[model samples]
Target chain A: MEILSLNQISPDQVVLLQWGVVRITATLLYTWVVMAILILVAILVGRKATADTAISRWQNLLEVVVSSIREQIREISQDEPDHYTAFIGTLFLFIGLSNLLLIVPGYVAPTSSLTTTAALAVCVFFAVPIYGISKNGLAYFKEYFQPTFIFFPFHVMGEFTRTLALMIRLFGNIMSHDKVIAILLAVTPLFFPIVMHALGLLIGMVQAYIFSILAMVYIASVTQAHESHGRGP
Target chain B: MHIDWFVFAAQIINFLILVALLKYFLYDRIVKAMDARQAGIASRMEEAERLRQEAGRHLQEMEEKKRQLDARVQEILNQAVRDAGAEKERLLALANEEAQESRRRWKETLAREREAFYDRLRLTSGEIIFSTIRRILGDMADAALEEHVVDTFVGRIRGMDEQAQELLRRSLDDSRSEVTLVSAFELRPDQQEKILSALGPFLSHDVTLRCEVRPELISGIELVSQGYRLAWSVQRHLETLEEAFKEALREELPEVNLENAGGEDAPAQEGSRQPHQSG
Candidate 1:
């Protein structure tokens, strides 16, 4: 008999394979599953896409999703969305898809694991500087010393803290929802877990939006810092 | 919460791969199609605007051409009217000239006919008057009348003006030709002696006296010396009376222009004289 408990907060506890220190956990497996699902849908829908006014519903849906992401990126960054669409759009889709799949029986979202959240947050952490440097060159570091060098250390610490905050915010929200639903099922074992599952869906979508939006804000700050500074308040 | 380094690394790699794949398949293709659709819409709008402007220009040109044609039509009509008026005036002038020429020719014809009538009347009147006179004189002829005609000749010589007498005297002195006396009847010996005694005053010297009978003289006598002649006759008196009647007729009918009457009167005058000459 399998015993269910709330002690297992992440899918990492389940190891699918072990090769002498090379171990594949449930998080990695589910991540591959999500990736495969996204890639397959993209390929299928892209195959028949056309620029004509009359289009398939699937193409229309895909176009709506893409243009919405681009519009959001443009609004946040105050610049063209082309440079950041791939990175920002993928982050939203991956996390959004993982959270949406929560409705499936026995399915574990990859975002529920601390490792996946940390990985996404780490990616955003590095993307900010990379986009900023591409726009402003080495001069991107000058933002640290802005308003006098006295705040330099605080500015440096701000970067690491923000990255940690991004990871914990997504992981805690999704994992707690999952853990609460498990507890509710074990305790009430009735319609209450269903209601929490519904709540979990809302929280899941919000987390995805917040994560992507925060990432864009960070990126725009660096990419457009020179322009903002040139405007003189 | 425990973090697994391997899982974290693998998830990052997965996300990066996902980004690359979705960009290639979805974002890039969709964005390209949308941009192309927008460009096509803009081009069609521009083409529509150009066609509209071209249509407007063509309409304006057609209107202009129609206006010009209307003006041209009006001008042509005006010219036709002017030409018609000029033609009407020209025809009227031509008609007037023809009427004037016709009137002139008609007047000329009437004048010619009138002159011919007048000439015939004069000739007829002269013939009748002379024929009557000749018959009367012929009925009265006798030896007593012949003696009286000689005595009348003698009286005419005695009644001559000084100028006439002087002219007869000069002619008798200048000529040595015979003095000839012609009479309508044969004179008795006493009658010849009477004519000789009547001419004695005009003769400056003795000349031969010749008496000739010429019935053409009617009831008259003539004395001839060289080219000079003295005559008294009824034919002369009748010719003078005819000329006076012609003058009176011409004055009465003034519209008859008698300037050319003289040429037409010659034959009539000669015809009138023939009866007397034969008589």
Candidate 2:
């Protein structure tokens, strides 16, 4: 192989840090900082929170944000508000922090990667019906071979396709927005980039909402399965 | 755009771990909180319903007690009114019975008083008549002196016509049409002599004289013919005067309770000495 010159090397660079047997990357360092900030803020604001009265300004703001997530969870749980409040609340916070990290100079949206979105989708796919099964027992699994024996193949394929669809949808939207901002910065380094960055911010928040709501919906759909046997999971 | 598989793979792992962590640590607590809230709301609603039912029961009890009190009060009032009515009726009945008994006693007392007055008048009139007749026939002790005079008068009256005798007998029989005659002595003529002289022609029979002293005929002779007698007496005039006095008393005594007045009016000896007989 011909050795390439310095001019030919890619602009991308990597710096690695090791702690014992573990290696931490620059990207992971950014992710950790974002996570740490989110956690500290969440805990400090929620320290003395109560259902009866507003605790503080920060606590009240956090409560408003959490209440919206709780509303979506309630909808996804289909009036079973007891099932998904905390799960969806945490999901919103994590993804929101990850998406907001994109505003930083060197950080990227974790959800912009196919692997990350796929992993999230897979967790949702497995967790949704698992909770459904746990809540309703083995009755959830029995709902898969619905309609008739001849329609079983179609139903099985549909489940795989739906989960794949969730992965692709989130990955595509976040990746495209990141790419568009990068491309705009390369073309013009001025006001155009600022608009694209703002758009990225908007899209990021929307994607977080969509993903968390969809996961909650998945959990709800399975719980409603036994009531409607003719429909597929 | 450039692709970075390693970064993508790490992110995918990170997202999966986060989702799982949240599901494990956070969801259970949130669900518990939500369930607790729901239970509290349900309990509050149940408590409210219980209080409302209790209030309704209390209200009904109060209403029932009020109704009972009102009915009891009304019953007492009605009983009192009925008792008052019965008392009024008893008093009225007693008053009416007492009034009727008093009226009967008053009428009996008045009749007794009238009979007693008439008896006293009759006794006084008899004494007057006996004294006056004795004075008028004084010194006629000869054996046929009064008989010769009566025979001469009776022969002259008998010699008249039979139609004249029947007229005299009719006049004597209708004593109410006789006029009063002026006489000093009280007359005590026999009813038989008067009848023989008055209707001798019509009877064509012998007549005899038998004197009878009647105090009711005080100053006039009474003539008798057939089954009738003609009478004129001072006692009759006194009876008219007593009738006038009784009429005046009746007119003046509209409000008097005369049934209780018997002890007041019996003090005079003249009023006490007479016999009482009521017609």
Candidate 1: stretches off by over 4 Å: A1-5, A187-192, A230-233, B55-279
Model 2: what TM-score?
0.46
State the weakest 10-residue window (summed lDDT) of model 1 chain B.
B270-279
Model 2 ranges with Cα > 4 A deviation: A1-23, A230-233, B1-279
Docking verdict class for candidate 2 = incorrect
lDDT, candidate 2, equals 0.58
Q: Please write out the lDDT profile of model 1 over residues B33-113, one tens digit for every residue.
A: 777777877787888889889989988998999999999999999999999999999999999988998898888888877
TM-score of chain B of 2: 0.30
**lDDT value for model 1:** 0.81
What's the true lDDT of residue B174 in model 2? 47
